[model samples]
Target: MTIRQRLNKQSICILMLILLMMIVTACKSDSENVEQGINDLEADSEQLNPSEEEEGPFIPEGKVQSPFNGKWIPKEAANKRPIALQINNSLAAYPQSGIAQADILYETLAEGNITRLMAVFHVYDSEKIGPIRSARHYFLDMAANHDAVYMHYGGSPQAYSYIQQTKAPNLDGLSWLDGIVCWRDPERRAIPRMLEHSVYTNQKHLEDGWERRELRKELKENFSSGLEFVKEGEEIIPWGQRADYVTVPFSASYTSSFDFDAETKKYVKYQSGNYHLDEEINEPLMFTNLILQRTKIHLIPGDTEGRREVAVIGSGTGYFISSGRAVAIEWQKSNHGTATEYIEKKSGKPIQLNPGKTYIGILPQNLEVSFQKKAINQ
Candidate 1:
């Protein structure tokens, strides 16, 4: 063959080889895309958002802003029977600071007209009972007389997690009487075990301090991105307590059972209240009013500590005077101890009854009253 003919033939063969390679590559790419599409279809529903597929109940968006706006009545006209006391001297004997005042109030209130009272304390880092005991015993003694007692704390979840895993000695004191917990905040706290669906932090962990930031992180890392949380409920089953009744900010749709989708790492809210083996179950959290005065009871909002704030609602469940027409004896704080006491102080005077305007600062000691009666006049 001539040189020009040979060159032309070589170019034709090369062109055919290139065409065959392009066809093979195109087929491989098409197959990959088809398989990917099918996997994507099976991974999630057709909708772009998983939240849209979520069908059950969810946390609310806002806190209870206004409580007891029109609910309160004037003190003078309030049905002032004796204060219902839940805390007493037996439960709170440490400080003796408010004991005198508590005795005076107890003596003054007529029999059958007294309230059952309880006291609470908030101690930071209650690691060991040294200086903290001064505060702890005081409240414990005060709460001795009330219907119930509570102690609150706010701490990093890491510390809590360590306690939970190790089961420290101090933890034994708090694991079961009325416990209330707020989820740890994610910004500052971490809870790894709670990431699963329906798994409850062991009840042995009812210690009061719950960092809010840690809870958010655990939930976000485990759940979807759009999950929004508000104060779900005030009645958190702290690592060790129980309540006679629990109220929620919103009613829960899931009652008890839980199933986890391991592939998606999603917690499926179950409707039954039983925790099944190999299933993660979470307790329904109770939403508490941040301002506290908006609660069912008409009193100031306060934490487990003696530090008081101006609240239009009651902090937790306790004795309250709604409309100032009913004298419901509830728990209050005192200067002496951490438990509830029944003593009320008005410029050193034993308050015969809890008026609608009882200043939490002056409330003598956490006192408990036994029997309470509404004024017959009302």
Candidate 2:
């Protein structure tokens, strides 16, 4: 062969070898890419749908579940009785302090067609709480049921009589501890806000009063809240009507409402045509559970100021609301010293609450409570 032809042949062979190398490299790279994509898909699937064997949230040692809300709390606070404070809920008492930390709150009718709030705190260390109000006789029964230390600015004649008869441990703002444990807030004492709604107190002050009075801080050995809660990872499918919005009317003048927040799965409170916000944090008051308890309530015969007498120690029909739904429930309080039992009407079992804060509204039987599947304004 000629030398030029031999050189051309050698060049052609080299070009063919180069093409073969490129093809092999491309095939290997495509295979590697496919393998990596499968691995990524598997990882994503594991994250989206966790295995049944996977564990839930980790709880630290020396922690115990709270009887009030079913949340984990420090072990030291497990046996400690909660504190029930009477908070003013009038229009002037807007933006009340430290109520967001309450594990459970109760609302009941007071004089003048207005409602009062009783906040029960199991684990709280806030700097301020209240706009403290006077205690009613029915509130004392609730406090006793929780074995909580009661704090109030003053009391009605019936309330004082009940306290004297039961010998319940309490700290009265009208007593000598007025300046020591409870005090008047300077801001609230200003004009436009009534002086009667200026009382305020903190956790430290309450603790001091409790220690001085030698009140029992720990719960009784056999005491129970009689509240059931769903387990972790469990969903509550209420077998009743949807309740995205709830309206609780105490009287023609005052009505309390709640709107369900889908993202947070909580019901945000509204009163006086505005959101009920906390003074300290300026955050809207929300609750995970709401219980509207219907019972007999009326004014005392021949009594002035329209003071109300609520019958709490008996069985009654009610509704338990949570997770944007509500279910009919029966509430029974056998006696003053025991916690109220709530049973589901459909299953005839104890009503189970979702883990978080709860609000119990003591409503009159004659009043009408309504709920809807969607927000009123939206």
Candidate 3:
């Protein structure tokens, strides 16, 4: 217990004190980090709670009824009333009795609330008429087999026209949801006297006819002009002078789903070549590959009153005819003259759609998309 021993003890005490102070500082730093994290979490919570102004897609009070409520159609609900009323009302400039071709389409459409559907029509070549002898294929096969959003079929104008002639089960009389023959009209669009025909069942006639050369160039340059010829409230117009007519049903919706540059490499839904990554990702229900819906709009022959003819436009191909624009979940390779490509449902103004062969998916209502690994958990 001399001076050296005393000095050693003092050094040990100082070392212990230093270690204790270091421990306290570390604890304080960890505590501060935890508190900051808690505060950040609280801020996020406050931001997410919907404000008075925001309203999500909450199912309203009372049991809502539509044709698309459950899985497939319930038996009792079959043979439901004709939806021609819904179709006619939607297309007429203002409701009118002249649109009397109701109750002709189908027997039962599930329920009074049937809102969604997957309609498949046959496409027959113009020359053939018999069902089996018909090309016996589906138009928009690429779309129907997969998603089923588009109002697609595989057949010729002859097939559809033949269907009209035979009065098929639920799809005989001309309604807005049926397929049409894409015929051309010279006076229809202001092209020329001889070159005014469309390419429905007369491809051979068109090619051989003197009008074909001029019309081909015109169609290539202005195939979209047909869309413009259709006035704001113009119902379905007749096909040239024939009793038959070309139709544009309001049953189709078009949209593309592609975003290769995204880090996730998923099919970006709703957003096309236009949305910013941050905006789409941050938005509610934002994801890729979800099916979009569309309404079916049919163009048909117009009733003539002397020189002025009146066409009927109906939209009863009920697919998500719910809160917003109806949902259209598929796109066909051949959508040149379809309604979904040319007009917006809410405004009826023409929208710039993806040209060429592209998958067209649409949700009629203003929709926000979400991703589900499997079917979305209820």
C-alpha positional error of residue 62 in candidate 3 after TM-score superposition, expressed in Å:
22
Taking all chains together, each candidate's TM-score versus the true structure is 0.21, 0.84, 0.22
* Residue-by-residue lDDT tens digits, candidate 2, 118-228: 999999999999989998999988887788889999899999999998887789988988887799988778857479989999998998888888888899889888788
RMSD of each: 25.9, 7.5, 22.5
How does each model score on lDDT?
A: 0.25, 0.88, 0.26
Instruction: Please list the residue runs of candidate 2 whose C-alpha ends up more than 4 Å from where it truly belongs after superposition.
Output: 1-58, 373-378
RMSD of 1: 25.9
Clashes of 3: 54
lDDT of 1 by residue, 99-138 (tens): 1111111111101222122212211121111001111222
On TM-score, the candidate that comes out on top is: 2
Model 3 agreement with the true structure over 10-80: per-residue lDDT tens digits: 99999999999999999999999999999999999879886766644333344222221111233443223
Given candidate 1, what's the lDDT at residue 377?
13
